[model samples]
Target chain A: MSKTVEIRWHGRGGQGAKTAALLLADVAFKTGKYVQGFPEYGPERMGAPITAYNRISDQPLTVHSNIYEPDYVVVVDETLLESIDVTNGLKADGAIIINSQRPKEELLPLLNGYQGGVYVLDAREISIRALGKNFPNSPMLAATVAVSGVMGREDFLGEMRQSFQHKFAKKPEVIDGNMMALELAFNQVGC
Target chain B: MAIRERLSGNEAVAYAIKQINPDVMPAFPITPSTEIPQYVANYIANGEIDTEFIHVESEHSAMSATLGASAAGARALTATSSCGMALMWEELYVAASDRLPIVLALVNRALTGPININADHSDSMGARDSGWIQIYAESNQEVYDNFLQAFPIAEHKDVMLPVMICQDGFITSHGVENILLVEDDKVKEFVGEYEPEHYLLHPTEKMAVGPYAVSNYYMETKRAQRQAMLNAKQVILDMAAKFEQMTGRKYGFFEEYRMEDAEYAIVIIGSAAGTCKAAIEEIRATTGKKVGLLKIRVFRPFPEEEIAQALSHVKAVAIMDRSEMFAGSCGPLGAEVRAALFQAKSQAEVVNYFYGLGGRDITVQDFMQVYDNLENIANTHVVTGMYDYIGLRER
Candidate 1:
């Protein structure tokens, strides 16, 4: 068996599904795991459903297709639950990280009897407060690493720092602020 | 040593992009071509390849951001399909006419409205008139190889036209097959390091890529662009030959199969040629009849002279087109083939079959059916695909 943890993310075109997946893989690599992050595309117009995936492993991985049954599913937009089936073909032992204003009880039925581990957070509010934007990719990914117990909270922060520093290297403050957002989300939802 | 892997054209495209190590990649995923960008992003994140993968909002922006990166003198690339290609249509033309060497991989799909997500050439046909140099591939290997050749072709000083390497959506892009890749060193040598002369964002160099050519010289500038595109023909042949010598794999503008001593032939492009080859062989064995398959690997800078020479002796030829040029009487490829052979001495009966629109699977048997129809129609009139008659739409 491979030492990778495969993640599948569901969201609309503009909701940063692909970004969140890439950030998770970047963080995983910084923690010394081989990773793969990508997205599935169709007529990916704005507001259309889309999926992005990540594979994190200690060793190299051979799986290169779409994540059919992923180890973790990150739902960036809770509204995707209505038209799109976010939880379909999820691994039995997988965990789902969702962005919702409501608690787990309110969102469980929307998952259609998905019995895997569930961690819910209002990443939208977190993004607005921490970064002054509606982009919840960084916070949601941080919450995922925290809930899934994939890596320590400290290592997750370190990875976020490295990734943010490089991505927005032009804007150090932006990187610093996103790192703060990751810490806040990590503190709000502990593994 | 390079690893042998079973990958789809989309995956091969992703693999090539990874090797190129682009500075920026932004692709709005469309079916057939979606997997290319996805794989590149994953590869970048995993540290398999170091690159910046931008998750752009739309295909138009995907192309726009790639232009931005390319203009900044960074190796930038992107992919799209069907409507996504249409969305990028205006920008794609600008990226080319402005002589920005942006490499784009287009997974060919039918454009929307009837909204078919299947394999076809409609997307590419829409951009055929765009100033971009277009190269078509028939397999996963071709996808990998053509992309390896595209960078140099696009960035060539005399031919600074943007290049679009196209493969059929699901037929070639989605189907998985084993392929032998050229060694990485060979790929690097074949494409060479990208050194931009007039990048937009470079501060030290005072140069411009996209400048307004007014009416007085717009036509002259357009003439220069055309001359540059024509100049690429020899460069492509030279590079493809060099690639063959290095990799022990032969590529050509046209790949002729069983074209010897044939009185009749089938001419088409894309993955459909694979089916035609199989059907021709089966028909020959059973009936001892001689028919050939002419696969058009290069669409633009249409290989008219070679095609005419190849079919000069054949009595009849059938052109299989996956997309229809609605306003015109003939399908796009069919019209081009007929025009190419119009001046040939042999009066070959050329018939056009416009089936398999929008990813409809065209099997070997379908080719045999068309071949059979070609023989009967050679002496009579043209036979076309069944159209929705006045009463057919009600069903």
Candidate 2:
């Protein structure tokens, strides 16, 4: 019953957008908040566009419907902007974060005149610099937390570090890289 | 203390399966429900439980192997969706008729034709008369809790029938959410042991299952099956009460939300009920309308009298169905609920709606519109468009 933060993620099938949404739900739940993470399912293909959603609240969530008017929208794959209306029902006061190095001015036109704040994170650059890979989900997740202020910066970093440690327990070397990517993305997301 | 965790509906059921550690699980893979067997198989491989895992060729063999295990006095279960269930149709009835206490984890999906892999009630609705004690869930937590109770309800002395615990495919089945899980010891103790009174493997006595009843005894066997179903109503309540004592979560044949003094109401089942609840909360907060919802948890042993009593006070009701019966009148739930009201001699105005077919999203706004229609009907005492579809494209 409390105020819920609704988020929608747009990405390709193999992009880990769904994984990022679920990871957000995991961290939020660890903070003692009720959370839901689900992806809009379709025929599975490598390059097909897919959508995922998240709901975080202080109280239990009763609604099982897809988010129409989202408080925040994260376009995990910037190319999806041309094919999908990622901001179809986005709240004007809320924000849209895109993982593009093309600058916010170029992406704004594709959003159908969305008047809310637009945030751009050069996720590829950040990921390559921090982790030496093209994994944009880690940076995009951090950018979302940084832009939305869902949790404090320090708290989000701490949670991500712990999560990475657990996820990469066998391969402990990758934990630091993922954490570095998150911190760099958290600090570098620009309006 | 209940362990706080987060899991998808399939994982939750698999976790419960790990806790109960049934004797045998014969399964074949199907979307939405495939994760269940996959997880259970992982547990077996990891030595988490000693449950026998049977990988069969098809769903028919999966269910046939399950019934074989149950008749041989091993606690048995299986998981399937859509056409897999249709393939198991004959075994479903045999499990009930032969009095085998089998538990089936059913991920409710749309039956094929257009070849869709989405959530709907058609798969389970089509099996309404297959003699299984059907229980539905609106969330992951409910599905987990319902699975824990399925064995107790199905194996009770007076109600030795198969149980189908159904959740919407790709909705609760795939959605991850927060859940409180009972302790492993508590679940094991609650589910208890499945000791059938008669079994084929008995050392001193011999028993035969699936016997061909002659024309003289066929009707009596059916009558006995119906009696078991009738007895299940009370058994379901008793088991729910016991489960509440252990976990502090109350369950019943159905859940009534804000129905005390409501003039407009909606009757629904499965995950959509959660959406309806959200809409009801908004309606009460904004316009102060007395809107309410009746979410059915037990569908097979239809709680006709109790549902009638709950809806008797409402002026107008919208009964929503997620599957089409194509009977030209209403869907499966609509037909049963209308008949229940008519039998109870209630004068409430009722409308049946078909919605959410083939994974079409049903939002709170759609429910708000249904409530608005209910208000119109209650005030004017005239019913317009008694049978209709929600979220349908019309010319």
Candidate 3:
């Protein structure tokens, strides 16, 4: 109740990391709170190391910028951690949410001093099982909501469903599949 | 109550931007101009202004995003220095030729190699041929005021060309001063919401921008851009007059400081104009040498008529340029001034004095040297390189 959560997302260009951040902001906003979403651009070519950000506050958010120090990080792809210092600016209470096939012990070096929380879910597995492809952005977002406690799980899921229904309104199958992936990853994170 | 505040030129630009209330800004920071974007971003973050600050990857993207936003019928802005501007040179030409009505506050910086981050007009002079209307500001006040005037001048239907307000880096961009600013609503009322006749990316309307200007119509498109530049002369004056009416402040193609009844005159541009103005006053008071100063504000549309008119009575004209165009026969602005004055029938013996190259400090004492040299000049057809340091080769 005393925590103000700031989330950072790590992914490559063309991987929908920015969309994930914006979606988190949208959901957080619907909860009658303040939020901002943005991305940092550097040589914005495909497969380049990219980061997007989100901040949710019960009060109005004034600062709008790329998140340098984040409270919780949602890792869309485990491999990005090798090239990225995911815990570079994480607070002591900060947490890591990774879509990894490896165990948490293997990720300890990457998460080093981050002792607040860790939510390990094979987002690739849930994404493959639900969407039949390795689109891990939604699963990572679900894992983020679980580990961060920025919004209630049910409200977050409802907002995610509403977003998909609007964005993929022309395709009902895609919307349903994305919602299922959200739920599967949410459950896998054990929130 | 008049509020006296001392602020850097970057602060002045930011102050003017707040007054202009441009809806969209896209920029990347480069030295000297870096503080400007930083300040603008700060304003956006603090809820002090409502605008879209597009954090772009490079100056090219910054200009491209500005063009996109401006074409979307939103007032757009951006700033850059040397290589940043160079990177956007191609897009900059397109933005101008297409008449996008974007205003850029350029902090003039030297081009890299020997990698100096100091002040110079070399970067801006390099882009002089890019078809955008360029205005050189002499002080922090002028930097703030010129940009406030730039919007209406650029967005005018008659002149939709992008406008650049160049202030010398560190000298003007970082130097602090106090100047008056008009009320916010005053500027808003003067410029008004941009109702563009031709815009891009409107869903309900149809318009073509930067279409293929192939062999057949390339010449015509270029002609249209040139005509737009030509049309800007009257538009600038009209806007200045309106600015005067609303704010009691007026600016023109050039500000003449004691140019009347002088045998010798020094015509300079940018912040150096202030130093020259002081030198003119000092020289007139002590030496009574009848020295005058003509500060060129409007660089593009060349102000040929006004320049010729200002120098018509003067016996000699020394054009001081802070940039060296190695490819050119003379300093960039010097060449342009010569071309402008050449039209005069007086044969007023114009000399190109390449001074202050690479941001070498040019003080009133330096202008005094040029003044003394101009008085002693027995030869009319010659160029003088002044204040040359030992390592620097004088051309």
Error of 2 at B38 (Å): 0.7
Model 1 lDDT tens row, A59-145: 644333456677888898899888777888887788888898998998898998999888897898998999899878878988888
Which runs in model 2 stand beyond 4 Å of their true positions?
B30-32
Find the candidate with the highest DockQ and give its number.
2
Predicted candidate 1 versus true structure: per-residue lDDT over B144-239, tens digit per residue: 989998888788887877888998886667555456676777676777888988886778877766678789988887888888888878777877
- Kindly list the per-residue Cα lDDT of model 2 for residues A30-88, writing each as its tens digit: 88889999999999899899999999999899899999999999999999999999999
Among incorrect, acceptable, medium and high, the docking class of model 2 is high
TM-score for predicted model 3 compared with the true structure = 0.65
* Candidate 3 per-residue lDDT over residues B21-115, each given as its tens digit: 78999987644346888888888889889988998888989999999998888899999888889999889888987789999889888897767
Arranged by TM-score with the best first, the candidates are: 2, 1, 3
Q: Compared with the true structure, what per-residue lDDT tens digits does model 2 show for residues B166-273?
A: 999989999999999999999989999998889899999977899889999999999999999999999999999999999999999999999999999899999999
> B272, model 2: CA deviation in Å?
0.9
Q: For each candidate, report what fraction of the true interface contacts it reproduces.
A: 0.00, 0.86, 0.00
Report the TM-score measured on chain A for model 3. 0.92
Q: Looking at candidate 1, what is the lDDT of residue B10?
A: 85
